[model samples]
Target: MDAEVGGTSAEEDYKPESWYKVKKGGKAVPMQREERQPEVSGAATQERPNHFKRAAGKKLAEKSVGKQHVRIPDGATRIILRPQGGLAPLTRLGAARLLYYVCKETGIFYGDARRDILSPNEALQTLLIATEDKKRAEKYQQIASITTEEGSKTEIKAHMTIPESRGKGVIHNVHLSVSDAEL
Candidate 1:
């Protein structure tokens, strides 16, 4: 192996010179130098990192609540919803009502009931899904009203009030065991 010395270039040494002869098996062998293309002039030799650009600048400042635009400052504020009872005791009708109201006011639709009482972070997962369905999301705002009206017409409260009546308590029972699909 050979290397460039001092100011000599890589090409100057890659080609065989008169002083040194290439040989194989104690016999002189013809060496074929591969042709190489010249680098482009003024071409950017330094690799640049890939950068992402958003053309819709400053438009991100405009906040959207469902389909409506809401103006707020660039600070964080927490809105608390205190359950009528402790979280554990929160029934499906109660949780759906609270969730409906929260979605109405905050423009965040978390869908319906959860088998487990979710923390704030887990609740945010529903928001990601909400982003896709803007119109249907508004339905969540009125879910409590629809549910209440339907329940009143069907005497749902009286039926659900019965203790340990599993199948009979449709709304309340489903609320306790509902999945992401219902949401």
Candidate 2:
């Protein structure tokens, strides 16, 4: 068997023992052994742009820089509206409820209110923008004045009370006359 394996009996060729003895279909055949080459051993190669770094770059701290100072007009009363006492649902929901109330009080359309209520931050932003005109919508301070009820799920009950504008071309009387002491 050894003589036949080495090709001395006219079956195989003489070669080093390191050669492979591949068995196929119940028959042993001599085949050259494959030499293993050195592999690229280290971190896996990156195929895409610095995606990991880019993702981390987006996580950097955000900074806001600005100064806001308002000079109150003489004889103009300052009204400080307090946040209703209640079990505030997350800040987002509070914002939504606030927005819904503002739009309703301001006589905004239901569809517009719905859209604003969907995004509280945006609604609050809009409300802030709408209140910028002091002469039109002066802040009022009266116990009977509109306010939110206190409870776990507090809701808004404020009304938009704008001052009267004395001008002839003013075809619409959309202003309310609250006591100056309240303003």
Candidate 3:
């Protein structure tokens, strides 16, 4: 706590003057009550009362490591695809081909689905694989969307920055569980 008396410094304000002096002998004896200054604003204030989370939240705000948490709406069923590991970013033409490859590999009808694999955050952000059927989308989520580079056998699977773990961090039945993947 701070007692601001018309713009006084902290050190001057922290120490309170003696209220009165009592005379005991020929020479006057001054009686003063001393008080310990409380930690008002600084690291010590948080450490004393366990305001640890504030410091953690401040640190988190300072260093934003990656993209904001990607959340898809729940009105539709969709599977999110993101390039995994050190795989090179797919060009627009390559993205289109990969979308087709994923649909073909997953046994989904190309007509019933819609994809946006070459969006603004193509390399980091997730591209969605959506269909009218919820079960098919869920099934596709289970299967890893993989593709090989043009010449070499560089097998890449579609994964994402954040794992699809929700509800107590337990892996539940896909049919009954909820995830951040639905679009």
Q: What is the lDDT of candidate 1?
A: 0.34
Q: What are the per-residue Cα lDDT tens digits for candidate 2 across 1-183?
A: 335535557434646665556586777666766687545544433523377776666655221112222443433333333334322342444655555444444555545434221222222321222333343233222212223344333333234423334233543544467554553
Q: List the lowest-lDDT window of 10 residues for candidate 2.
A: 117-126
Regions more than 4 Å wrong, model 1: 1-74, 89-98, 104-183
Best by TM-score: 3
C-alpha TM-score for every candidate: 0.17, 0.28, 0.36
At residue 96, give the lDDT of candidate 2: 56
Note the Cα lDDT for every prediction shown. Answer: 0.34, 0.39, 0.53
Highest lDDT scorer = 3
Q: Local error of candidate 1 at 21, Å?
A: 74
Scored by lDDT, model 3 comes in at 0.53
RMSD of each: 18.4, 22.2, 14.9
User: Between the candidate structures 1 and 3, which one is better when assessed by TM-score?
Assistant: 3
Question: Which of the predicted structures, 1 or 2, would earn the higher TM-score when compared with the native?
Answer: 2
Cα displacement (angstroms), candidate 1, residue 71, comes to 22
For model 3, what is the error of residue 8's alpha carbon versus the real structure, in angstroms, after optimal superposition? 47
Clashing pairs in 2: none
